[model samples]
Target chain A: MKHTISVLVENHSGVLSRITGLFSRRGFNIESLAVGPTQDPEVSRITIIADGDEHTVEQIEKQLNKLIEVIKVRTLTKDECFARELMLVKVSCPAEKRSEIMTIAEMTEAKIVDVTLTTVTLEICARYQKLERFIEIVAPYGITELVRTGTIAIQKGSETMDRKK
Target chain B: MKMKACQAMVECLKAENIKVVFGYPGAAICPFYDALMDSGIKHVLVRHEANAGHEASGMARMTGKPAVCVVTSGPGAVNLITAIATAYADSIPIVCITGQVNTDQIGSDVFQEADITGAAEPFVKHSYLVKDPNDIPRVFKEAFYIAGSGRPGPVLIDMPMDVQKAEIDFEYPKKADIRSYKPTLKGNAFQVKRVMAELEKAKKPLICIGGGVFAANAQDEVVKLSHTMNIPVITTMMGISVFSDDDPLFFGMLGSHGVPAANRAVNECDVLFLVGARVGDRAVRTPLALEQTTKILHIDIDPAELGKNIRVDFPLVGDAKNVLTQLLERAKPMQHDEWLAQLESWRVERKFATAKKGTVVPRQFIDKLSRRLPDNTVVVADVGQNQIWTATSFHIGEGGRFMTSGGMGTMGYSLPAAIGAKIADPKRPVIAICGDGSLQMCMMELATAVQNDVRVKLVVMTNKRLGMVRELQTKGYNGRETAVFLDGSPDFIKLAEAYGIRSCRVTDDRSADEAISLLAEYDGIALVEVIVDENEATL
Candidate 1:
């Protein structure tokens, strides 16, 4: 099972390592992670995607909360939050095959960020499942490179995992 | 007033009311030493940076306050890792200051440069790398506060050499108020009521304690709770000295090396109130099985520890003293005479046979030696079988302390820790009990003791081998022993003589009795080397 843990931490230099170090030390499996400054300039929000069962995920949240810099930790389920990951995929497309690849990109709502004589690069930002689908559709065209900014999430409704908690 | 960052660091210590520090100096940290010389605080120069750490740990464990240790960069700071990890494992409060190379040269790996804060991140409660000279006061304040606060542990502050020399307008903070670091002190009222309800319904109730009880200074509250409710108490290895083994309601330590009575009581207890104990594998070999049968209500300052090792039935996150006081206030007079009688029936006392003509039994010697010491004697036990012997055999009377590297089980802990314990309270009797192998590991510290004029008693049970590992080989490895023998070990009596410390070697019952009296009565630092049987066992 995959669990998304949203953590609010002090916006300090070493706070990220404190969270990563804890995950590594406790042997928790981190599938993906993304951190950015939050609404308050002094606080940062880290979205961690970890692979664990119900018990292990609970343990992970408890352990994360132990760090002195961590202000809040909430294990958001897929239903409770909206998640997004921006990915860039470069395909080896000759001039002749450009139209076919462009058609596929247009259907997937991926923007053509860069283009060259021999290759084409498209950028997409969507939920994890949509990103995977885009990659599958573009794989036939021969992907030369692919990179992803691991999942970042926010609450679906007015609820927020901020210092207010 | 404008002052160098290093001077401000010393001022911060003075503000915390620190009287002394243990450290070893090097090039990177010389500036701090220079500033310390005029600060009116005594500095004990430890032989090794590692010993400095252990010594500070000893002080912290004794005083219930965060103690300080300083060392230089690279190897100097690296050497203190063992002691820091040991303190982290046992939840001892210590503020470790290490000097880094020039701020610009830190990552270039210049001479004596090390990323100590990065290296110690996993072991420390929190760490700070002071880039700006003005951050010294705030960092020092936060370091001390974090090190001594809820679920206390070591904290590291790595100061760059250039930063230490930079001048800053000094203004020490009166209090630490980190936004994300507030600890829950009082127990939840509903949870406290829930625990009381469980206590009322439990037929076989048991209370298990750990080092957290001492950290919280809640020994009185725990004892009061036990007596008021007539509930039996058991302890983990770190929880020793909370109650003597002879106390009618006090059961022995639990886990792998624990007594049969305490382990059985844990098995039979319907409600096990675990306070401040981590329930490590050694303390509870099979937590799952016990959780299935027993209702475990765990109260610890660190919420992570509640269900880290076992499945907790009711988890209460708060300081041990405050939560225990809450339970005490809401308690009703109750007794479990039948439960106490059943636990008593399960108790089995071991009787050791007398020592042979020229070989003294280590356990028997410890038993005799402990009886002669004062009620408040501080006993520091090293790792391996010597720790087991002392933990199982030594009787800790009222106000006595039994300090050990329980969680980390590090070797060579006793000698330096005993010296630090003595430094904390000069009037109390402090003793370090170690095996021959463990003694050799820290034997260098005898020079520190003699140089500082710290009168600490040392007892070395010399079997010429690492007895614990040797015993394991004999039992589990087809009796093939390897690397367990101390083939080139120096005679401890002669070593003590070289250090100009009074010492004795006991070989038999008569000599053991005489040496015990001599070591106990000696006003100066002393060592007693007792030759034991090669195959002596630990229970």
Candidate 2:
């Protein structure tokens, strides 16, 4: 099962490797990880969704805490968090089929970022599943290139990651 | 309380950040293994002393730290020579601790007595023979530092049986001050400038790389040089993935078994600028014959490499990366159209790979296996054809790494070292590449991998013969295969199964595909055995 986790860490070299390393070393599949700077320049937040049993997650949290760079880590389950994923996918499109591709993009509320001689780039933002589904349906159009910003999570209630237990 | 040499060794190990060691217990080395009890420095007993030494090399490669291998003196120490030489060649930081003959019997040639210090000197960076127990602490500290620092290579500490038998008011020295041993970190300014001036004047320049590029963490600098100069870069097998192929200037690896473009470029280029590498037989198989009038500038930290093969016009005996940075200041911006064009013309779909003539091509299997793993996975390749294939076909990502016995070319390296790498970062995927012959030399370490819960996927290119020798016979000799194999080989999957590790076998492309799928999906230590025909060329 995929469990979202918010990990706060010191901005240090090799810290990201250490975080991902814990899951990999433990033989857990880390679904996705999105790391970015918070308001504090010294601290960065790593939002990770990893597949593991509760004990494995508990171990992961403990391992993260053990790293000198890690400040804190907390499980941000789907029920307690609101999340979105962003992706930019370039699909092969014939000149005549451009309008048909644009129409599909419009219905999904995704914008067409670029149109080249042979490809059309679509900008998407939604739940991970929604984006995946959109891409799956459009894959027959031929995915030439893809870039996804993994997934980022924030608590649904007024509580921020730092404010939550 | 009188501390045994074993206890003293443990104390030194803890101070050196050594989390684990691989070894076997003998009459002399048994006490040290016993001392490991209650000691946090985990001691893994291998099936043989040679494997212990090889494992230490793997550990060092995996963790970027010095690794220890302990064994009894005499035959045991002799066993470690091949392993030590491999570390020496690859420049992996390994500190070997061997049980020696009692101090009283120095030259008596008693049973299990050998001049281990004298034996190891030619191969090791530094060899220390300790007679007194008091020197243990200082020697241990120095051994660790020397093994890991500067050019990273193996160092030996042979403790007398009496010394391990004696006690020490052990005082672990934190610093080492050796007058003769200070490594040159900064390049000579004048030489650097001279190089820079030449680089500018030459329209066609190519950078021939060695293992030293990665050793100095000069990947960025190398990338900078190639980008700024628009110079094509070719590497020794050891220098393989230090830079990415996506980098346009990457001419691919050079030497006898190198990419045709790289070799052809070496022949075609007017200026061959060697950086931080030894122009070995592998790098410059046809050093004598040049397609064009080539001028070579050998830049290496070790002075011996300057005139060793091809006489160096500019023999700057300094660190390759350090000197290259200095040369960057003076290197010109001239480009050669004809040279670049001719070099490009030499390319024939430019793949650095070969196949087994008699049976399955190992490169195809290894490349397929490598593709299944994540781009950032680490492959610890043993010496021989396995290392060659790994260097050629395993496309490393930004963090994907390849570690092997480059200098000594030690066979039994994969399994144990992967354990250390796995320990270094348990979450990152670590795989070991070995041949069937090499795998037998260190197969006992499967126990170590399982015991530590350090799972490193073991991928063996099992050809059931000494593939390197086989290659040599074909390439160098008249296809005369010698003492290369025994009739029956042990069932590796069953062997791994015995150790409670999952395993898969790949005989054909179909089994290869299925095997790759399973190996990638499995979490713990999995053995993927690929059967290649006996007639394979390493290059």
**Predicted model with the maximum DockQ:** 1
* Backbone collision tally, model 1: 0
lDDT of 1 by residue, B297-326 (tens): 999999888788999988898999999999
Tell me each candidate's i-RMS in Å.
1.0, 19.9
Model 2 misplacement above 4 A: A1-165, B1-6, B290-292, B327-342, B350-360, B471-482, B534-539
- Which window of ten consecutive residues has the lowest lDDT sum in model 2 chain A? A62-71
Best by TM-score: 1
Q: What is the DockQ for all candidates, taken in turn?
A: 0.85, 0.01
Tens digit of per-residue lDDT, candidate 1, span A35-126:
99977899889999999888899899888877888999998888988899999999999999999988988888899999999999999999
lDDT winner = 1
Q: Which stretches in model 1 have alpha-carbon errors above 4 Å?
A: A163-165
